[model samples]
Target: MSKQKKLRKADAATIRRVLALIAPYRLSVAATLVLAAVTVISTLYAPVLTGQGVDLIVGPGDVDFAALITLGVQLLVTILITVTAQWVMNLVNNRITFQVVRDIRVKAFEHMQVLPLSYMDAHRPGDAISRITTDVEQFSDGLLMGFTQLFTGVLTILGTLGIMLVIEWRIALIVVLLTPLSIFVARFIAEHTYSMFKVQSETRAEMTSLVEELVGNEHLVRAFGYESRAEERFEKINLDLQRCGIRAVFYSSISNPATRFVNSLVYAAVGVIGAFLAIGGSITVGGLYAFLNYANQYTKPFNDISSVMTELQNALACAQRVFDLIDEDPIRPDAPDAKVLPHGAGKVEFDHVKFRYVPDVPLIEDMCLKAEPGQRIALVGPTGCGKTTLVNLLMRFYEINGGSLRVDGQPIDTVTRDSLRANFGMVLQETWLKAGTIAENIAYGKPDATREEIIAAAKQARAHSFICRMPNGYDTVISEDGGNISQGQKQLLCIARVMLRRPPILILDEATSSIDTRTEILVQSAFEELMKGRTSFIVAHRLSTIKNADCILVMKAGNIIERGTHEELLARGGFYAQLYQSQFARS
Candidate 1:
């Protein structure tokens, strides 16, 4: 309904989720609470002991030496216990806070792995990275502050109030009357600032995403001469973040001073009333002194808590982002009684298959095809003609909207996704190589492959010569995304990875597009060897690449207009022939 109501609901949910994360470490939490209590009790009792010691000295010589000595010893002991408990409590709090944060980050990452590709396509990589990293760090800082400061503040406040009442009800009543002022001030500031802090968190995520996008594509920005425009764009986002941050801090900062001012009034009232009570013999000097100490102690936690509230608000906002990631709906699970696809003949059938990325947009409709065992089915088409989409469907990255896709006569949906995907080796035009040695990259698809196997695969992909030239050869470590190597090298590594797997089916989506013509010919020969007996689905824009394919399906606007051998399609003098002629036509 209202923003306030929404904020309240969100805060409640975040707190509940945070508590759930902490639940597994309940023993540590319980210990922290016990130590907090012990710290507070021992701390509060010291003032009483001090007051007694003060009363013990009527005059310089009128002091009771034996009794004063014992009081002093007891107060010393109480202070030591307070310090020790507080130190141990901090240790437990640190452990619990960090452990919970670690769990949240882990769960968020695990969830991301199972999330559908559509989810990643819909969200920015930078934003997702921010949630698991920057946001989680913020959440950790906030949780730690709450554990270290907020708990102690609350316990101190309650403990002091109880001790104050016992020492002098009249002065304690004054504090009780003024207590609501501090709370109201903190609550008023907190409610207004929570929304601002949430805005700040969102803005921070946007900045993170922008920075990542710009930095990762700096070459493209420079190539387009967009340096000035890129700077302007970045400045705009940074300004928004600055504005949100400033407003959030300005509003949250008000609570501390506002609560401090209220608590000061409470403190002054207690001191004035306590002094009069001592003067009129309504309370002892020692008792009045204890009441004053309790009054100050009681009010100080309000100040500490008010400050902690600002941090908690920011923390809760960040926690909400992380929890959102953790709660995202994962990819649809495999069917009940789903069987693993056994390694059989590579016979794939698409029967009246229908699909679309968006429900309202028609992409592939009533599409049907079949690949007998060991046949190479090349998909040639214009951009957005569903060539790549077709390959994605075969891999089950996206399920067909209608009709059945079968691998060896068994409907693919009936098989576990892992098994179905395991049967196909894929290499796309856009290659991915993790930060590791060249050998490790080649052995990615088959982690248990031996050194000889990795070397053989690399040689097959025409990458072994280049690999051997590197300083460390197979052990040379590559930077992230293989930035240390050429694009062709990265693609070769990817191809080598797939070759190592040697799956029953292959999907090469412009897999050799990055290599030079000479290298392409070599890799093509390798592919010919690799595809000798496997059903291959090749998505290519270059007509020459698929000229020798067993069958070429020429597609346009989401439908296949022609399908036949390359020679047969060309002889038909149809769409396929026109496309082939256009590719090699004289200028």
Candidate 2:
């Protein structure tokens, strides 16, 4: 009820989502609560026995050894039972909490796989990692601690209140009257912390992003001598995070002590009131002691729960971010009527295709191109002139706005996305390799590739010699994100991956950009040989790269201004000729 009353509208939704995450673990939760309840009962019995033991003291306040020993044995048993129950309850609670958190993390990762690249483009990968790793842990810790305290705290309060009433109604009234005062103070302090905690969460995420960026590009930062600037940026974010954390903690710090102080006042009132009741012979000394113990017990849960109010609010803020990501609509799945695409002969036709990164900003309008089986198509233009965009469209990475893209006489959209993409191989300007052995990275697209297949592909991509020079050759483990290897080596690994796939169509977007001229010539020769029977789309900034292309579409701005082989474009003395000559002239 306290948690329910404190939650605002936004938190209400997040709380529900978090509860949904726990719904599947209802049996474990129920078992944990049952253990907690047993612990509460065992715990509540101790103070009652303590008061009874006090009742056995001699009239002159001398030690009643024989009776004291008997009571001590009972008290020891109660304490052991209480301790054992709590320990087992804690074990169960932790298991449930971690499993609930793990399930959410797994679901979030699976959702990420189905999300389109457009979503990834709009957000940083580090922020997503924070949601899965940082936020989930925060939520799990709060839930774990919250559950342990909540179950026992509730039972302790209600049990103590009932026992206090049975012991003395007058003292029970004092505790009942002061409970609201403690709650009021806690609520006031906790309300202010919610906003501060929200800010703290955002600041923490910003710091995570900065750390990821700096570590990811440590080489670039040092090469450019930007260490001071990086430190300055980090200090700015770190200070902001520190300030937000201090304010959030400061506000939360006030809540527990304030609640405890209010409850302490009630404790004093109960003591003062119980003494008078005893003096008037209305209740026995034993009754007085039991009521005091019960009154303290009744108020302590409120204090304990108040102590965790700040933690709960911080957890709720994290829960909101994680839920926001979970609630994101994933990329559209294949249509209900979608059919599997047959193996391709690589006949691609772009029929009056229209595309743009953003709507209303026309990039490629009414663009037409046709590539028969075994033809080499080159797209050449300045940066951002829809060269890579064409490759993206052909591979169905982005859906074309106003056209049908067909492969071997079948409309691409009519088939399942998996089958549509399975026929094509791509090597982008940005090469990606995971932390794995050289053989594993090369065999990424085809996990079952034989050792000979892997070595053959590596040799064709010109990666074999360098790979052999490494300590473990194909079995050597690369560092994270392929950072241990050179950029050209990473590119070669990517090329080797594509070569192993041997798809019917290929898209090479400046694949040779990272290598030296000498290495590029060798890699290019391997690619040229590999491209012989596949429909290939090559996007090249270097005009010389397209000299032998079967067809080259010279793009300017977004549209193709000229189309021909290299010789025809030069003879026309047009945009292509001007662009081609300008490169050599500069060199």
lDDT of 1 by residue, 342-420 (tens): 8779999999999999999999998989999999999987888989888889888888999999999899999999999
- Give the poorly placed runs of model 1, Cα more than 4 Å off: 58-61, 64-67
Lowest lDDT 10-residue stretch of candidate 1: 163-172
Off by over 4 Å in 2: 1-7, 61-64
Prediction RMSDs, each to the true structure: 1.3, 2.4
Give model 2 RMSD, 1 decimal.
2.4
Candidate 2, residues 468-570: lDDT per residue as tens digits?
9999999999986699889999999999999998999999998999988999999999999899899999999888888989999998777989999999999
Q: Can you give the TM-score per candidate against the true fold?
A: 0.98, 0.96
User: Cα miss at 465, model 1 (Å)?
Assistant: 1.0
Clashes of 1: 0
Q: Assess each prediction's global lDDT (C-alpha) against the native.
A: 0.90, 0.87
